[model samples]
Target: MTKFILTAFNPANGQRARLHYDNATSELTSESGESLVQAVEVVARANAPAVSKQTPLAKSSPRVLKISLGLSCNYACEYCSQRFVPRADETNPGDVQAFVDGLDSWVTSPPEKVEFWGGEPLVYIKTMRPLAEAIRSKFPNAELSVITNGSLLNDEINDWLDRMGFSVGISHDGPGQPVRGPDPLQDPEQRAAIMALYARLAPQRRISFNAMVNRENASRAAIQRFFIELTGDPAVPIGEGSFVDAYDEGGIAHSLRPGELHAYRNLAFHEIRTGQAANVQAVSSKTASFVNSIRSRRPASSLGQKCGMDKTESIAVDLRGNVLTCQNVSAASTAPNGQPHHIGHVSDLAAVKLNTATHWSKRENCPSCPMLQICQGSCMFLEGPLWDRSCDNAFSDAVPIFAAGIEFLTGLVPFHIEGELRDDRKDIFGFSEQVKPSRDRPPRVFPIPVVAA
Candidate 1:
């Protein structure tokens, strides 16, 4: 309900501008009451999709279907979200026939997107192949996608994926591969398979090498350079180039320390402004969206979480028909607050509930946070220390991009956000409000950014 005062400075000179941002109304205006938006649309706050412990989302005919193949993987990445989730019995190829048979009953109509998820999806290729094939036969035009570590990719699998028009995302940490375990790029067979798949799918713009940034791998510029060099493609699109959320001990260990936030944001902003990360999907997509939000004066009431899983029409389920809060979790697991991840069964769509999550608006911080438009709150189900650490990482990670979006639209880089937020989050890019943008320059040159949930 409170409007935030943003302290911004034009890099051309030491001139400053004060802009007021209203989170609830999503209006941005200057000192003279000139709205950043040429026109503003006032939507009722009652329209906001608010979910809490008692008010959980209910699933029905879904437009976005996420099918969890299983919580099994070949490589145990240091910060994998599924690493600790209690696994149900492993789904096998035997379950696909029955899953496919029941899909029509619950699906009702053709889904817009059908994404296959796994601890590493290809780990369940046998089950995935049949499941995806059946879904494809039923809804050929639906967008089929999967993300993997690329260790299991082969010529046969690549060909099948290409024929099916699947959008494949290889999850590699680029230079941060050491911390993620074995590097597929280092293995001759895996490298060849990955590159071959890339060559086949790049023509259709269906492949992207996804990377995650953490305290250990904070530089998107470095990550971008690494992928471009490895792939020999100047414009290779990078996916998920955002900071990691702390799901467990490994995630917390890899999260940015309190002391590192300023430096990280500075480097990130420097890279973004210089176009070093222009090809990063997260950077391009998020910056553009943030800018549009300003132009439209997008109200927080219309916003959803970073992940669309909170919507009633966006549902995730396992092979056995167990509905989940999201793809990263398993039905056999329990959320940190003791809520069951297995909220319901797909057979009874009307009975399915998403109680494991709390919507962004339900959280005390999100409604007043400066980065609400871009962050929407880190992970809907995460709680306690994990949520705190994840929120910390997300704040520092978003500040630079938030600044970039403001700089693009108003020619003023935001240095501080004055609002009812944590004191440390006020000074963006770790520069005091008194400092000019030109004087508070990044130590190194070159860049580009993404907004992840």
Candidate 2:
């Protein structure tokens, strides 16, 4: 079993621990101080499950299915995940009936959740309505969800959505509107329609204002406050709080800049701790999972991709029946790793082979990363500069949660990571000076700190 030293601090009481950690089988064997012994009970009770069982693509049946309408969208957000993806053949409302007929045979069992996708799903209102209607009829109890930019919503559309029992997510970067290209909130008609839909769905837990963090829109607390003020609801739920995946030039421009990683993590950790960003799922969920991993001693090998696209049972397909790599990419697109994103068609599930993705285990750095459980390998198919930029963003995004989780479990926030990982990654949240060499081994002088871009 590989062993490493981890240094952390408890923000609550400013207590510190230099703990011994096992990598091959995850466990915190001991701490420098005897005072932490009782508080370590949290680790024993966490008991997080291993990653989902893997199955061959040909034999798997998905419980979570995403249907892609098309790549068509109304607004051009600078950092949209799909901005650079290649477009596939467009499917129209006419394709819905055929798509519905195929599902009975294609889907081995009823999906628990069916997501309607598009560049802006509402942009294909014609196709979306009929397709959603068919899916609802087939899987009557399934959770139907859609994410739209609020520009197209109206009384008629909102009423239809309510009747259909859909959980809607409206995409808006509240305070960072200019970077996102347009503000649907600025238009009087769109604003009214958005409020109307919000009024209709708020009580049912069926609506949320989806937001993403980028260099320009870095503050979750600020984002939350803006939404709360705009909606006049103090307890508004926010979705998609993770950092933006850098896809192209536009995406690169918005990704975290050099030396900003430490600042971002500090801000994020403070916001999460103060409950200012409690509505953000990315913060709350990651913090919980990270804490449980430590408590349960979950190994790095048990971790899966951040997006479950590597799982055979998490499927994405178009009305034309072509199964795709994931919802963020289209069938016509090719992954940066030089593989086509389209795996196979639903008509021939047995022949399908998902060659597009590389699991976290396959990534060169993932296994050694202290943030493996948190970052989980950003974007399975991204490669080259895109992958590099995304990995940078993931590192900064996860460090705060990493520190918070450790603080919760052992009252020690990890200021630095030391062991099998690269020398550069050992410093957590840019706190390189805090790392002290083990007394048993001679200390090797480290180079000057290089800020991650």
Best by TM-score: 1
TM match of model 1 to true structure:
0.94
| lDDT for each candidate structure | 0.85, 0.78
lDDT of 2 by residue, 409-450 (tens): 666566777788767566766754754535464434343222
Worst 10 residues of 1 by lDDT: 444-453
* Per-structure clash totals for the candidates: 9, 3
For model 1, residues 1-453, the per-residue Cα lDDT tens digits are 578888776676646677888776667789678876665453344355777668888898989999999888999899999898898898999999999899878998899999999998998998899889899999998999999999999999999999998999999999999987789999999999999999999888999999999988888889999989988999998999989999999999999988888888888888898899888887888888787777776777788888888888999999999999899888889987688999999889899888888888888788778888888878999999999999999888888888888888778776778889988888776546335334365432212222221
Task: Count clashing residue pairs in model 1.
Answer: 9
